[model samples]
Target: MSSVCSTFISSSALSIKPKCANPSRSRSKLRINCTVGDVFVFSESVIEQKAVSTAEPLLVSAVRGENVERPPVWLMRQAGRYMKSYQIICEKYPSFRERSENVDLVVEISLQPWKVFKPDGVILFSDILTPLSGMNIPFDIVKGKGPVIFNPIKEAADVDKVREFVPKEYVPYVGEALTILRQEVKNEAAVLGFVGAPFTLASYVVEGGSSKHFSKIKRLAFSKPKVLHALLQKFTDSMAKYIQYQADNGAQAVQIFDSWATELSPVDFDEFSLPYLKQIVDTVKQSHPELPLILYASGSGGLLERLPSTGVDVVSLDWTVDMADGRRRLGPSVAVQGNVDPGVLFGSKDFITNRIMDTVRKAGSGKHILNLGHGIVVGTPEENVAHFFEVAKGIRY
Candidate 1:
């Protein structure tokens, strides 16, 4: 029967194609039949099981931190600014402008990383300013300075100018991108969706872009705590809905990027950042409890102890902190990700391999995800990335 089934259906079904399955949903059963030219034969019993979908298995499994034969590897900014293919694509769409402006292009760009790296997952290819663009805040990604806000939110009135809920139209771009990604990439890689945390988002809005000291945001946090809270509340509400939109579409897991949380001390983080961040995490988790949510804060070495309390499933560390020390500080409740310096990718392959091996070893035997301390630099050597993974796969532990 099994031979008959293989003979009938194997020809048409074995061509590698992308498929998606939501573990939260009911199971899908598959049956086999053999087709010898025109003759058909049935297999044993109908295969009773969950759907045979093609979405990457490793990424989804890693989100749950399930013990796997090997650790899945992918980098921050895995989807952008590195590959020659990506540059060529951008050159083709010269006026494509910022990523959020073109959903189709954005989807294509997002898939580039997965195709080139064959990494375990694909981070969505949209900017951190994406949600703000949805809110109609005048923003643009400048060549060198990063996201430049044309309309900065300063006073209480300016806060009200932006919509409390992200516009519905903007939601589909992300969902559409995920749909396209699901169709494009082979099943071995997972698609990851991310949003900026409220504090980081608020800092951008308050400070009007990247900053040295974040003085304006700090003043707002200290002087007019209610206003800052209100802004954060608005962002938290919108961001929660935005993240949920991604999950419902096809994103296997989500991450909250709190890049500026390092700017705040522990007291300030608890007061101005943690509460709002917790709100977003709690709300999102309520709906999708099994979906892995990672909270990554750049320069957040001081707040390691405070991270688990935010209700995040994973806490990503930056390069400033030692991974072993971070492991000790974080205890064992939440999985830890990252701490490899991205700059090290510019070093010799031997140097890169040693660093990757050391980080993997130092992270010890708890729930850990290997990643760069931050996004890859624009001109990183491809060989170094290859070497990094070679070391990762070669590590015994």
Candidate 2:
């Protein structure tokens, strides 16, 4: 019922305006008349049968369950410490806050990986905690100690002090940066925007910083469930609006990082994390139904099945789960991204190639995004990261 643009492999560059409904077959002989640019080069074989819109980014198409030649590729933290260029920038701008908050710096840091690797997705360089300060929660990313909350919230009164996020007023730089990124990337890649999930954001503010045992947040969850729920609600509302704001500002897709939610038991996660996540997803979908929403939780092997209930378009896996198992477990309703070990980059180039092939093969043909299970490690070889993208882009269905 929808009109979409598709490129055919004929003599010249032909942009065909075609109206095609989603075919019933998962793998159909008919080629989909949807525009997936140079980043996704499909072979003569059939494409997946999901309804797609007009020429969108390859990552957007892949996540929408549309059949593409190969899965779109982008790492979780593709724009961080691993690159020499990023390190050089860090030397100049010592403060992580300065690097992430300033519009020019955010755009430059975000595009660093895009320039070098030409990733299919150029995610915002801002931190999940970037919005915390705007929400009346003071925090800082210390060089060695990681994130530090000035005053950890432990009670109802502290939760009361948390202000609702006003992205335009507080973080207009985020919107500006995303707008610029979209202009830079054009139709070649998806400009990804991300926010920390309510539970994870709550964890950071509740625990005061990163924690190994996570006892502080768990204590608050187990003992003072009401207080934790109150805080989570505030974050849920704020982040849902934040996603909308990003999408309105030209972010093609937005990912929700629930990095610390895996620490909870299934029962606890259901009570604390699931509802808030679902609320955020439901809220965003109501307004931006076409925007792809991705949810990621590190070490989420145990929580895979529960993830789909949140209604996100994609579920990113950590390395603990096998690609084959993750694909089978998540089924076809949700697209899958990642599960490659970041440490694999340290292995030989042949090993990295084999792993990429193995993951691609296991993920089957459609609805996959080749990525590291987690962020590229601090010491990951830049050449290997380049190799990861090279092998990934060369894959065909």
Candidate 3:
């Protein structure tokens, strides 16, 4: 009898071969024939369950501080504009919201990187502000202008209008995509889910989208602290639920992106960002203790020591900090990811290899996830990225 696996059938599905980096490995052991769609039906054979390959993904093991051969590798925006395949998809579906919110498009976009790079983790292709529309805040991801909030929350009344996020109702596509990604990747790699941290979410909603100085949010924080606090509270409760939803729906680990949290001074971060992050971490921990939570704050060199206090299992560092120093500062209590400059990918192959080796060595043996300090920049040489993963995979303790 042949084993079976769930497969989504649709016109948009792309046929691709499974990972067989070593030609010696039999196709039967690794194949997971799947496609991108919503209507699900079983295919001929499931991803094989081989006795030797059943161990948990290296990413999960490393996150738990378990000793492993080397750090598992994946990039922040591994499945976005940088890929030619993704760009083709984007051309067909020009609307960012359409591409990201639809289940079929989400699954296809998320798997594009997996198909080529075979990164150790496959993250869902969605946005941090995805929940905003569900939260009663109308928004759009304009092509060039970026996120555009129809009505920016300015006063106390706006806080009351902001609803708590209900992930299943608001973003069912997210759950569906993650579930499909799990079957597609199997234990070969971990499936990752993510959400925007409260303050960062609040920043977008409050500032009406991306801001240069973030003056409006700071003004609210300084003058009407209570109002800002109210907004943060709603986001905190909603994001906690969002994290739990992602984990329960096949996400092996969830990353909390606090991209704008570092915009606040240490003193302000403690007041606006830190406590809310702690609340989300605490809320999720009670329900899903085994679910690893990773926190990332862009340009976080000033707040490295304080990140672990949120109780996340891993802390991701941007390129501003040295990997060795970041590892020391973050300490051994939490695992570490990133610190490589994404620009390194634009350099010569040898230069990229050396940087990968340097970061891995500085990160030490276990409790590390190799990644770029930030998302892969647009116009990056795809060949160099291939080199990055090639060198990273070849590393041995």
TM-scores, in order shown? 0.82, 0.87, 0.87
The Cα error of candidate 2 at residue 90, in Å, is: 0.6
lDDT tens digits, residues 1-397, model 2?
Answer: 1111122222021232223334333353433333323333222221122233347889998988887878889998888788899999999999999999999999999999988778889999999999998999999999999999999999999999999999999999999999999888887889999999999999999889998899999999889999999999999999999999999999999999999999999999999999999999999999999999999999899999999999999999988899999988988889999978999999876677667766776788889988989988899988788767765665567
The residue pairs found clashing in candidate 1 are 5-34, 8-34, 8-35, 56-187
Which scores greater on lDDT, model 1 or model 2? 2
- Candidate 1 per-residue lDDT over residues 1-397, each given as its tens digit: 2322322223332232212222222234333433222222222321231234474466566556576544557899977677787778767765435555577788878877655456666878877777786686777777656778888787888887878665357656778878777666646567788999999999998888999999999988888888888889889999999888888877877899998987998888888889988998889889988778899998887788999999998888888999889988887778888878999999866567556656665776446778899999998987667656644543333
Clashing pairs in 2: 48-67
Q: Which window of 10 residues has the lowest lDDT sum in candidate 3?
A: 1-10
Candidate 1: where are CA atoms >4 Å away?
1-56, 94-97, 394-397
**Per-candidate alpha-carbon RMSD to the true structure:** 12.2, 9.8, 10.6
lDDT of 2 at 71: 80
Worst 10-residue lDDT window, candidate 1: 16-25
Model 3 TM-score, 2 decimals: 0.87
Candidates 1 and 3 compared: the better one by TM-score is 3
TM-score of 2: 0.87
